[model samples]
Target chain A: MTAQPDQRITISVDAMGGDKGPATVISGMAKSAEKNPELGYILHGPEDELREMIARRRGGQMLLDRISFRDARDVVTMEDKPSHVVRHGKGTSMWSTLESVRLGEAHGAVSCGNTGALMALSMMRLRKLPGVTRPAIAILWPSRNPQGFNVMLDVGADVRADATDLLQFALMGASYARNGLDLPRPRIGLLNVGTEEHKGRSELKKAHEMIESFADRANFEFVGFVEGGDIPGNRTDVIITDGFTGNVAIKTGEGTASLIGDLLREAFRYSPLSRIASVLALTSLKRLQKRIDPRRVNGGVFLGLNGTVVKSHGGADDTGVSAAIKLAFQLAKSDFSEKLAARVASTVELAQDEVHFASATQEKQEGS
Target chain B: MTAQPDQRITISVDAMGGDKGPATVISGMAKSAEKNPELGYILHGPEDELREMIARRRGGQMLLDRISFRDARDVVTMEDKPSHVVRHGKGTSMWSTLESVRLGEAHGAVSCGNTGALMALSMMRLRKLPGVTRPAIAILWPSRNPQGFNVMLDVGADVRADATDLLQFALMGASYARNGLDLPRPRIGLLNVGTEEHKGRSELKKAHEMIESFADRANFEFVGFVEGGDIPGNRTDVIITDGFTGNVAIKTGEGTASLIGDLLREAFRYSPLSRIASVLALTSLKRLQKRIDPRRVNGGVFLGLNGTVVKSHGGADDTGVSAAIKLAFQLAKSDFSEKLAARVASTVELAQDEVHFASATQEKQEGS
Candidate 1:
């Protein structure tokens, strides 16, 4: 269940995870393995497909030992039922890959596929932390703040949640800040309708009180409510929210940024003069575009669970898949789970009692 | 209260209705008036502030006869409580300006100060459409769909709403679409967790069914449920939700869009090589940027009320204020309210009956 300080980290990848399946994943893994000598990769998917893909991208037999393959058949689609994905697809590529992490055959798992199914399967297999009713997906966004990255949690794992769930997400995100990203103490801000206490919905208002009251347990600076503008503005190191809003906000941010980039490209293509100018400025513009490319931060960590899981972009190609594998390896090599567990365990005894008390109090208030 | 088809619609600008008060509002009004000569303007803020600002901007008093001033002692602040602004500030610029619309002195009233207070006063004075419960604030966003502008209602007006309230928002949005925006039969989509029948919170689920079953009475297309991204991507013309989610989504989109624009500029500024290219690309980039500028589409129309009240940007300066004034005048000249009323009247009886029947059916289901 634990790794020694000098032990090499192993990662299990669902090679058949993305749109291009094992071929693109193996190509990326082969390239990454050459770069990271100490890293080990377990490619879990159909035997023939994994072997064929690996052979196509192989540098030779010398690099072949760095990867080992396992057979897994079923593939979960975006339209698949979450329950069905978790129940019927136990022997599937995604499920077997996640099980490797749970069984400690791998330090972490990476899947570039259906987000909902992955979350459900991971939760069912690895189980949620003791005080955690529902886990959250935490993403580190490159921020303008003094901190290089701001960790935002509950991206899409749980849609409707209570105050306790939000508190748990904050705890998990703070742990991630320290262990995964190596921040001293992440400054956490709850996403709200406004900065004021009187802002946001009744649920958020209630969650704010719990976050403030239990501030020390999470071991992060509770910086109060942050607005949507504050996310990209880099005013805070961590933003916490319910899954629905968080998912929408993240997707919107991604979509808008892409739209702007496309618009800029079109703008440079407008006229002959503009095109010539764009060609002249291409170097500077390219640097600028690279600064916010989501591909640079290609994976979201599914936090507050038993083991680390990195969810890559469903449409990611070889380069993006490589980035995700690198990220997952980095997470596994770090003291992520230990630090996360200590943070969660620090307040474990009273976590459930507090949650119950808060929920009861809220229910009484609403009922009255 | 309708103008002749050939009559030129007039709008009165509360030339003191923004953060900077009269100087900026007047400047904006003057610019908008110059752009559209057929649109008559009546400036109703402090006379001296308007005169000084207009003179400074080299605007001639050519339209002096068309403009009028109604002096008010106080102006609302962005920080002021909505209730306090409504109760104590009877003679405030916002109240007096809205009075002009109520009494038909102007077809529409534009105010950049105290959006909540403006909406409240409009509701109190102009009154709601006979069968409507809660009025909503509808803002149009540019979309990729070839069909129509995306209308997100309850942007920040009603904080808490029931199933019936959302249903009313749907009707109001559809009416506004058909009459004001000139969509023959607007398609209404409920913003929910998913497109599934059982998706989203219980309240949204009930509202979805009510909307679907009420298709007999509702003139618009009820396209079932839609996810958040669908709202801004131009998938649906009319998106209905309670104020909480709608406000969050709109703010997220606006802030994120602006943030991306800022990042894009920063991207181009990264190096001298790109700077030259950016210069060549400037004109086309500017054209595209204008297409998504927060300032150009800053005005939000408050719908379902008896009169048209346009809410301007809280932080609006002269140019943004001017854009809001122009938008308000255009909507007023269009006589949005009369059009909305006629549209709502034809479907009111059917909508009301469906709503009652829905609640009863829901209660029976819940009991079982």
Candidate 2:
């Protein structure tokens, strides 16, 4: 469909979501709007404060035309209980953003607020897409392929998951790969300790069997099991796992990048001669650093929700906030949610039929 | 406690470990010996190949009194099954190295071979330390702390674990911190989904209660739950988790470092002007990189073992091998096994008695 003259994809951004808060979130949205003409935004926070930020950015005209305001008197602190905050603190920018999605006023909601709160409220308010029991937070991870951006799901939504949840995550992650990244037949792998068909925890094995049963009809290529190290190896385009494992992996990866950056700094400071040699090698070093900067891949889209929920890093700065807004716009414009809902509904139908067939076959075998 | 004239600690080194095996292992040992006089080594591999490498370094006669040799016929490939290769290939360098530890010729074995094999062989040969149902490989992670390393255990040994295993890991890790890092009283934390005591998988809650039960003993500080991000936060000295989680975290960290290094290289390749800015910032970046290089902190001591079992990174170079050897020496001279065995044995005794007393008290209450 061509762009609707008046029906813009209005995104509600949690202005007080990250470490940088309203200032950086507003700045990022302003920068993002400079490049995308069709994107519109609604700043969800204290109205006066958000307006001040917009005025400072010289975005008064855009604010008047495309941007509006949603006043949230309360802000969710990092330590606030997710359930309580989402329940009692209805005025929080995070809750307000999700409210916009629920009210059909925005195409998506983006926030760098308390992760647990965003997840809790999004699931509580927007509800999961039909046939998806648990919605996953999907992030594009650094991969070995030069152009690779491997999609990983369930980063921190549902910690204790079953085989069915894993399969749902796979379907959702595949939809993201197809609809968000615009790829055909994204290679999907079940994240496990080993690649063998029989390897991995019992839940993973059951999930594997379910995925295998639907191999013919599933949207993505089932590439079997993948190990922890393979996430960065870029061997598969989409990786599926429970939220607990994915969250740990993502945080570990971030911590490691910070550690390596620290190490490189120490290596270059060995001696005056060594420092000079490092300076000479700066051209090559910077080439590598920019390719894997966390800032470039800072947002995780909460998939399978009725509307999009974008999660920026808890430690996001202005640059990262900008990237998150751009990411949210891309997801909104791509209209991946509708496509994801359809794909999930079809997959669940196929999985249920397989379950029924298996039971029937077992009964027949017993009768014989 | 002075070096007993006859109480020597011989550690077997795998000459054929990693991509650069014999050359790097040999050079690393040479470098290690130059720094530690009390350390002795028994390099195992093909006689001709090892001698050729040793000759290139110094033509022999240097540290000959401190080092010896053992010959093995084959090498373990990365893809080899730990169980089959360890059981069937006794004459291989990997097995021979473990054999030295088993035969009491060495206090510990250091290998950059497949980690799975080393962990399997160590358990099968030396047996688990008293009350340690399963052994864990503990890595001394480079921290932002100026003091030294953060100890993380079960770095890919046990895939599935119970609360009991976590308790055992915490005790073993505490021993390492107290003896290895010389922490008088180590701060211990359970790696969980969140810092909240109840915010993790069911097993985490049980583990938390168990750790708290021992808080009165005052052997170590029970810092309760720590999230995955806490590993790099430098908040606790010892972080304990199951092998699957630890392994994934460690590998994710390594892969992230590699990815960041790649990104930095790309940032500098944009243009000459950018290259100059990279040069100006090169010193700080180099310092950061060296602070987290896997080579500098390569050796991960497999704790909860009758004897020291140092599991080197499979992709370790010479520097890594040397670091493993050095760690082996420190572990050996420190008489870690005796301390570890005593602590485990005592902990088990305490736990058993506590259980028995609790059951008896419950019976009396029921009778009343």
Q: Judged by lDDT, which candidate is best? A: 2
Q: What would the per-residue lDDT of candidate 1 be over residues B1-368, giving only the tens digit for each residue?
A: 56666776677677665777676676677677778776776666667766666666664566565577777767777777777877887877788888887788788878887777787888887898877788888888766556425787888887777888888788788877766567877788988766767556788888887777765566788988877767656667898887867777777677677756676677678777767667767787888878777787778888888777788887787678777777776676666788777766766766667678999999999999
Q: What is the DockQ of candidate 1?
A: 0.51
Give the alpha-carbon lDDT of every model.
Answer: 0.77, 0.79
DockQ, each predicted model = 0.51, 0.41
* TM-score, second chain, candidate 1: 0.90
Best-matching candidate per DockQ:
1
lDDT of 2 by residue, B1-368 (tens): 12245576677887885776677777778888888766788878998877766766673558555677888988887677777885787888888887887777887788888777777877887788768788888998876654567899878787877899988888888999988889988889888878876487999899899887886673999999987776776778899888878877877777766766666667666677657656666666656655666788888888887788887777777677778888888778888878888889999999889899999999999999
lDDT of 2: 0.79
Tens-digit lDDT track for model 1 on A1-368?
Answer: 56667677788898765877667777777767878887887878887866765666547465567777778887887677788887799778899899899888998899998888899999999998766788899887756766556788888887777887888787888778877677787788888767877766777888888878777766678888988777776667888887877776776566566666666677777788988877787776666666666777888889888998999888887777888888888777776876777778776766667779999999999999
Local lDDT at B13 for model 1: 72
Model 2 chain B poorest ten-residue lDDT run: B1-10
- Candidate 2 lDDT, tens digit per residue, A227-267? 88788877788888888888888887877666666667566
- In CAPRI terms, model 2 is classed as acceptable
